[model samples]
Target: MASRSFAEEDFSCPVCCDIFINPVLLSCSHSFCSSCIQRVWRNKTLKECPVCRTTSSNDHPPVNLALRNLCESFQQERKPKSGPGVCSVHNETIKLFCLDDQQPVCVVCRDSRKHTNHRFCPVDEAVADNKEILKASLERLQEELRRSVNREQKLCKTAGDIKVHAQDTETQIKDEFKELRQFLDDEEAARITALREEEEKRSQRMKEKIEETSKQISSLTITIRDIEEQMKTEDVSFLQNVKATLQRFVFVSVLLNSNHHS
Candidate 1:
C-alpha cells in the first residue's frame, strides 16, 4: 500500500512513477520524467506543462533524493531467483565471467575464439585489486588533504601580514590627512595666504583617495603573488614517484589515471 501511495503521488513521472528520479515539474504543477522533460525543453526553454499548457522555464529540475533512495532500497530488498543464462554464449546457470579478465565464465562462451590464450583469474583476484586500488586512492587523498591544510595555513599567515601592513598604511594615511587638514585650515584663516580654500580641500580629498587605493593595491598584490607561488611550487618529482609506485601492480590505465584523479 505504501509503495502504491508513493507510485500514485502527485507530480510523479510517467516513465518512473514511483517518485521521480529527477522530477521536472511544469508550470501547471504537473511533473514528468527528466528525460521526457529534456526532450520537451530542447524544443522550447519556455515550455508549457503537458497537462495544462501553463508556462515554465526548463532551467531547473527537482530531485526528491529521499524518496528515490527509499524506492531503491525497497526494490533491492526483494531478492530475485538465481537462474541459468538464457543465452548460449552464457549457458543457463553459468555467468559470463570475462575469460581474459579472469571473471566468471559460461561454458557456452568457452569457445577458443573468446577465451583463447586468456588466463581466467578468479573473482577473488579482481576483488583484491579493487581493495588495493581503493587503499591507494585513500592514501593519495590523505596526502592531498595534508597539502591543502598546509596551503591554508600559509595563506592565512600571508593574509595576516597583508592585513597588518594595510593597517599600518591606514594609520600613516590618517596622519598625513590630519596634517593636510591642519595646513588647509591654517591657510584659510591666514589673511595674506595665496592658497584658495576650495583648491586646498580638493587636494586633501584626492590625497586621501590615493592613499586608500594604494593600501588596497598592496593587499591585492600580496595575495595574488602568494597564490601564484603556491601553485608554481608543485613537486613534480613527488608526483613522478607516486605514479611509478602505482604502476607496479595495476593496469597502466589505472596507474596513469591515478595521477589525474589524485
Candidate 2:
C-alpha cells in the first residue's frame, strides 16, 4: 500500500484528472489516456496538445505499453489498508492537493479563502509531478558527482606524474655529479702520481751523484796519504812516486769540477 501510494500518482493522466486508461504517448513524450485525448481532439479545431501548444503530427499516437504495464503493477499494489482516511482539520476526506503550499487539503480547505486563488491538483498528480522533479534533481546531482570524481582522478594522476618526474630529475642530477666527482678524483690521482714519479727520479739522481762524489773524495784522500809517506822517504823515493801521485791528483780534480757543474 505504501509503494502504491508513492507510485500511484505517476500513473495518473493530466486529462480526465485521474489514473490513465489505455495511455498513449505523444511526440512530446507526454502520456494521456487514449479515450481522453480522442475526446479532447473531437471538439478542437487545431490538432494541438492541451498541455503544450505543440501540434500533433499523428492523429492516433502509439500506445505507451510500458507506462500501462507500470500502472497495472501500481494498481496491484493498491489493495486497501486500514486507516481513517480523513483530514484532521476539516474532518473530511483528503482528496485535493494545494499546489502553491505543497499540502494536502480537504474539500472544505480547498474552498477556504486561503486557497481561493491557489492552483489545485489531485493528490496523485501532485505527487507524480514532485517525484519527476526529484528524479531530475537526483540525475543532475549524480552527474555532478561523477564529474567531481573525474576531476579528482585527473589531479591525482598529474600529481603522481610530477613526483615521478622529480625523482627522475633528481636521479639524473646525482648520476651527473657522481661522474664529475669521479673524473676529478681520477685527474687528481694522475697529477699526484706524476708528481711522486718526478720527485723520486730527482732524489735518485741526487743520491747517485752524492755516492760518486764520496768515492772520488775517498780515492783522493788515499792518494794524498801515499804522497805524504813518499815525501818522508827522502829525495830518491820522492822522485820515483811523484809522477804517479801528480797524475792521480789531476784526475781527482777534474772529476770534482765535473760534479760541481752537474
Candidate 3:
C-alpha cells in the first residue's frame, strides 16, 4: 500500500481560503466549506458562487468522507486542541463524558435514540468519566510513540543497517535525528496552519459583528437628521404665519381708528 501523505493543511475551501470543513464540491470542480458557501450566498445575494462563479444554491452535497478522514489524520498527527470537539455518535456535547464503549454521550443519553430508554447522568455529575476518557486518549498516543521508537531501534540493531564499519553508530544517530526532525517539521507546520485557520474564524465572526454595528449606527444617524430637518421646516412655517396675521390685524385697526376720527 502506498503511504499517502495527507495534504490536509495545504488545501483550503476556495471561497473562504481557510482550512476545509464540511467541504462540498461544485459542478465546476471547485470546492468550498459548506458554511462558507451558505454565508457568502446569504450575504452576496448572487446566483453564482464566489469561488467557481458557477450558479449556486443552498443545496449541500453529502460531506466528503475522504476529506473527513484526512482531517482526522491531520489532527492526530498535529495533536492540536482546536480539533473538532463534538461527539461522533451522540452528536451532542461531550463535556465531562466517558470514552469507553458507546461513549461521549450527553446527560439525556437515552441511547439508541429509538429503542432503549437508558438513563444517563449529567456530564458534571460524573467527574471520573472525563478523566478516564482523557487518560485513554493519552495512553493511546503514548503507545503509538513507543511503537515508533521500537521500530527505529530495530533499524539500528545491526552493522549492515548503517553500512559503515567505523562510523556506523554515528550514521544511526544521524538517521534518528533526521526522523525526529521530519516529525517535528510536520507537526509544527500543521500547528501553524491550524492556528491560522482559527484566527481567521475569530476574525470573520468579529467582522460580522462590526458590520452589524456599523449598519445600526448609520441607521440611527439618518433617523436623527431626518427628525431635525422636519422640526426646522415646521418652525419656519409657524413663524411666517404669526408675522402675517399680526400685520393684517394692525392694518385693520389703523383704518378703523382713522375713519372714526374723521
Cand. 2 Cα-lDDT: 0.63
User: What order do you get sorting by TM-score, best first?
Assistant: 2, 1, 3
Error at 181, model 1, angstroms? 3.2
Error of 1 at 175 (Å): 2.0
The lDDT per prediction is 0.47, 0.63, 0.47
Clashes of each: 7, 0, 0
Best by lDDT: 2
lDDT of residue 14 for candidate 2:
85
Q: In model 3, which runs have C-alpha deviations exceeding 4 angstroms?
A: 1-9, 43-45, 80-262
Better of 2 and 3 by lDDT: 2
Q: Which residues of candidate 2, in runs, are more than 4 Å off?
A: 1-88, 181-262
TM-score of each: 0.33, 0.35, 0.27
Q: Which lDDT value does model 2 have at 60? A: 94
